[model samples]
Target: MTTPSTLPAAPGPTPAPAPAAVPAPLPRRRRRAPKAPSALLSRAGVTALLALATLYTLLPLTWLLLSSTKSRADLFGTNGFAPGREMHLAENLEQLITADGGVYLRWILNTVAYAGVGALLAAVFGVAAGYAFDKLAFPGKERLFSLVLLGVMVPGTALAIPLFLLAAEAGLVNTFWSVFLPGLVFPFGVYLARVFSASHVPDEVLEAARMDGASEFRAFRTIAFPMLAPGFVTIFLFQFTQIWNSFFLPLVMLSDQDLYPVNLGLYVWYSSALSQGHPEDYLLAVVGSLVAVAPLIAVFLMLQRFWKSGMTAGAVK
Candidate 1:
């Protein structure tokens, strides 16, 4: 039976069922949300803040300026910011110069000596030490640097008594050296010098200088010094300001009035005016303050360019 035409052709081998049709997936097109702009304060708000800060800083100085021009009666009687009936700026200057047999001039000279010479020496010392610290290798270098950093944290007031004691032992108390010598060891200046040296002075330049038959000191003096000039000026200005405004150190060291710096002199005048019931002395004090601030202003103006350069020397790459 199977051989007979394959039994109806074996039902054509039971033809396979047609496969079900499947749809293709659509291409995914993801849509992203737009980002919002960042919020910022208006320009007016920033300008207002800066103007407020400037007013706060300059308000006192403006009051002092106005006060310096007032007469003794007007100084206390009138509003601090108002002009007096009679301008006494000229009279105040005369009195300031002639007081205590011209002792204020002595104070000015003493301040110059202490601040100028001391700052110069301190710059020299600081720059040399910083260069050595940055470039030279020695045992205990890091430890010594750490000590210098520690010194930076110690306030000048804390060191005044010890410095006075040391000066007394060295027979320098009640002398100009007592005040001047202490101004020569500014740890902050050294720290700044080190930072400047590290950032501004390259090792390869120094090495090249050495290869040109320059000794260490010669190399520093010729090559490194030029590179470190901005740093030196920065250190000098810092030390100068510190020495100029120093009061406690001079108070502890100098017993003689002729050796007083401007700050101590002003303090003495202010204290005497308070205790002696002398109202004119109060006007004198105000005038003296104005006079004292003049030099600092002049110095800042004169050295503004150098100061700016020095301050920003190591800031950028």
Candidate 2:
């Protein structure tokens, strides 16, 4: 007990702990200036502008949908934005199908054939060309690709006459081949495929396939094409939509009502309404237009995810 009491002279009164260091005061941040009134006005203006743009786009479709539900009487008499007093959509559809010996159905079938077959072949060619551009080196490759880019710049409308002339020379004008063949040449699809190839596909994998004694075509079929699926879907949808909506080209090439796409057929009906004073033709055209629009919407909805992913994939490293 005594030894414990004498330890280190009682530890020199337990040396008071060093005074706690006070941290220097932090520098204060500068206060933000109040927002200017113009800043608020600018935000409000931008919001208003976007709202107007949205309204502009949706208003027409809204009118189309509402009008499609109405009979001829209601379509012209009732509120443009409001629903019909009685839905005549079924009757309109029946008229659309039965009118002119079921020509509308034939037009639909022709359009589907044109859009589907053309888009399919175009996507295939475009993917092949794009893959060649990205992976396979050849003489005049860059120059050829530049020519393709030039093709993209040339509007389809501008090319309509030239295409018609080419079709005429081949004795294909006014035939399905005339429209189908032109749609198969999608330079933009080639460009998009090249972009997707560069982004999504790796050269190492291709080299590995080649090392495994795979031919270029075999490698593409088995390895590259699968990897480029998103791009292919995107291209197909684009080409399909393009061919589906092609009016000027078909108009320039075809005079036969039997070969008319839905759009052209609807236009024929609409023109007849104006010139021949057929009231029912007007409603038929409206309903036909709505029907024609359905495929586009359906295709977009079904494939939007793939399209979005394909588009975004190219943006990444």
Which candidate number would show the highest TM-score if scored against the true structure?
A: 1
TM-score of each: 0.86, 0.85
Writing each residue's lDDT as its tens digit, candidate 1 over 1-317 gives 36544344334477789999888989889887766543335577677888999999999889989999888889889998788999888988999999989998998999999998999999999999998999889999999999999999999999999998899889999998899888889898888888889988899998898888899999889888898888888888889888999999999999899999989998988988999987777777888889888887887788778878877765784
Candidate 2 per-residue lDDT, tens place, 1-317, comes to 35545445433456678899999999999999987777436989889888999999999888999999998999889899999999888988888889999999999999999998889999999999999999999999999999999999999999998888888889998898888788889999999999989988899999999999999999999999998999999999999999999899999999999999999999999999999999899999998999999999998999999888877865765
Q: How accurate is candidate 2 locally (lDDT)?
A: 0.92
Question: Which residue pairs in model 2 clash with each other?
Answer: none
- Which sections of candidate 1 miss by over 4 Å? 1-42, 312-317
Lowest lDDT sum, 10 consecutive residues, model 1, at: 3-12
Compared with the true structure, all predictions reach lDDT values of: 0.88, 0.92
